[model samples]
Target: MRSLAGLAALVAAASVFLYLLSTHLPPGPTRGPPGSAEEEEVEEDGGVQEYRLKFPSDLDELRELAEMLKFYNREHHGYVLLLFCSAYLYKQSFAIPGSSFLNMLAGAIFGPWEGLALACLLTTVGSTFCFLLSSAFGKQHVVQRFPEKVALLQRKVEENRSSLFFFLLFLRFFPMTPNWFLNITCPVLNIPMPIFFSSVFIGLIPYNFICVRTGSMLSEISSLDDIFSWGTLAQLLAIALMALLPGALIKRYGEAHLKVDGVDSNGPSRAEVKPVRERW
Candidate 1:
């Protein structure tokens, strides 16, 4: 209950901060700063119009929002970046969904290369923040809420303990399991921070790249279907399969010759698995 309360309080605080930031921002596409040449150009094009600054639910809304931000980015560039980062981190830290829209938005505003870089960086940092928050405040609540899931993942982690990093990579690349669940449950699995961080940063590059690249052509995208079509899914599955190969090789090699504390060299000795279970 204390863990639940702590998580609730932190989430509420983050929500309020984002709310305040959103409300304070200028609401529409406007000219550059006063007396600037861009201001005249913007005025000649037409005065800024109101647009809702909210999470877009569809492609059309995403395009509108992206255009609005791009227009705002002209004059309040720093604020635009801060707003994007803050919102991205907020969703990530809280395990909220809908970041695909934001990734595309970054591409639309920052262009392809910059957007991909920003998306990858933010995905890593934001996910790490989520991991830390889960470790700090949500561990107990997560275990209680999803006992079976917790047990299953714990078992899988133990099974892949020798090649945990590749297993983590496989999970990220595959997307069979939702990323939020991993972020929240990893601490409970006792995965090391460095491994978790590295896996997330590296594992998500392809996913982030696709989103940002699609965002670069946001104007042409008619629907989310275009983003996650059969081809893309197949490609991701291929990458996920490749990720598993290293872990498979590692496990096979370990079983064939590995020894634990001078124990049997055939398979994972009882000695190897005992300590991990004891820790849990």
Candidate 2:
């Protein structure tokens, strides 16, 4: 059993390596050549195939890049090329923890609603890709390293292998579940791409909406940039605390009545807890 588990881990790792090797495009968002590119894909596949972002090699600085795009957009009718490149980079550069910066930039460049929408779309797509890659290569080792967290997410997924949308929704809505970890683990567990996508479709909308809309207001808004602002930080903390509420309640309710698993009927069982579906 251990051997088989090891083999599965090896295979998953190999799959991720292959995926990394297979892509040339910079990850998040890159520009498309407007109508012609769209037409080519439409003509070939009857529907356009969406590309997974890999990462940009050229621009080391975002502000400079944004300024260039701003200039081009002003010169032309719009900045579709910039949109494409930005999206491509955002999606491909999975290592960066990019929300606050991206939101601010989007607001500065794109205004509120559209800027927000773009952020949400870019994030969802990028996040999904990361999930796939991580699940393919790192989930096995990830599970080994963080068994508790892995089990928590596994139960969440097990309930919805046939319903990824529900699973994604559950994970997204529930602040307790680790969204990043789940993304990587889902593929390794063989949740179909379509199903994985269904989860994204339903799950990401609300948070996306919130962040993007808030960002869109950036052009008109002027506030401090404290990472730990009072109001917003308090709200975030509240949400985190709210998720822990259930466990707290359960513990308080059963504190005195809890029994040892290995105890015989007459007394406390001392069976070694070799990990058996303990929920947090």
Candidate 3:
């Protein structure tokens, strides 16, 4: 019952927040002239369908929103920025999907450089909120649900403590693992906040630029695949490899120095250098 009440409260709060946000925005386009093709389709589906607003999960819906915002770009710039930032933050805080659409929308509305900056800033901020929120509310649940994975991650983090920042950079750059999982696990693994923030801010630059640039060319993109061609993927792979290089070098040099000093690379050496007592 407590859980149910909490869930209800969360939903209510989100609804109120969204309602407030919507009220501040410029009105959407008026319904297509009555009895036009859009209305005809609505009538064919029954009037009930026309009144309901579905969640913006469909690409068509996102594209439509982008189109609508384009009309108000010059007139209501502040409101648009506020709305975009708020919505993006909310999405990230809850680990919601569809950020790809938002990234594209940023490019479409702000152009590439500005869009890239916005995407990175909003992502870092939102992800910070997510990290803190997960630390408070979801950490135990995640640990309970995936003990083995958590343990493995903990071990890996411990093993790479010296180069953890670079390891994090690699994770952010490549994103082979989901961001939400990383947000949750990083807190649980006790990674420092500064390191997490720095790594996320810097490591996301290349990928964010790619995503934003794709948005700048929104008109040319017919599918997501079009944005991530083989050439693009290869470039991204190269960037990820580059990000990993520093950590790899650090580890390699540290191992070499340890070997030269007659120390075990994996552990302390058994041999000890002791001062010999002088014969008096």
| Model 2 lDDT per residue over 87-178, tens place | 43443324354454555456445765666666666666766767655654455565566555444445545544554455455555543444
In model 3, what are the clashing residue pairs, if there are any? Answer: none
Per-model CA lDDT versus the true structure: 0.75, 0.49, 0.66
Clashing pairs in 1: none
How many steric overlaps are in each model, in order? 0, 30, 0
Please report the candidate that would top TM-score against the real structure: 1
Of the candidates shown, which would achieve the greatest lDDT relative to the real structure?
1
TM-score of each: 0.74, 0.49, 0.67
lDDT value, residue 242 of candidate 2: 49
Any runs in candidate 2 off by more than 4 Å, and if so which? Answer: 1-73, 76-95, 159-164, 222-280
Cα RMSD for candidates in order? 8.5, 13.1, 10.8
Residue 205, candidate 1: how far off, in angstroms? 0.6
lDDT (10s digit) by residue, model 3, range 1-280: 4544554576578768866776655643333335555456546665422222223565667556665565455567888788778788878777787778888888877887789999999888888887887666666666666555555556556666877887677667556556767777788888889999888888777667766766667634667896688866665576466546654664465455322232221322223422221111
TM-score of 1: 0.74
Looking at model 2, residue 59 earns an lDDT score of 26
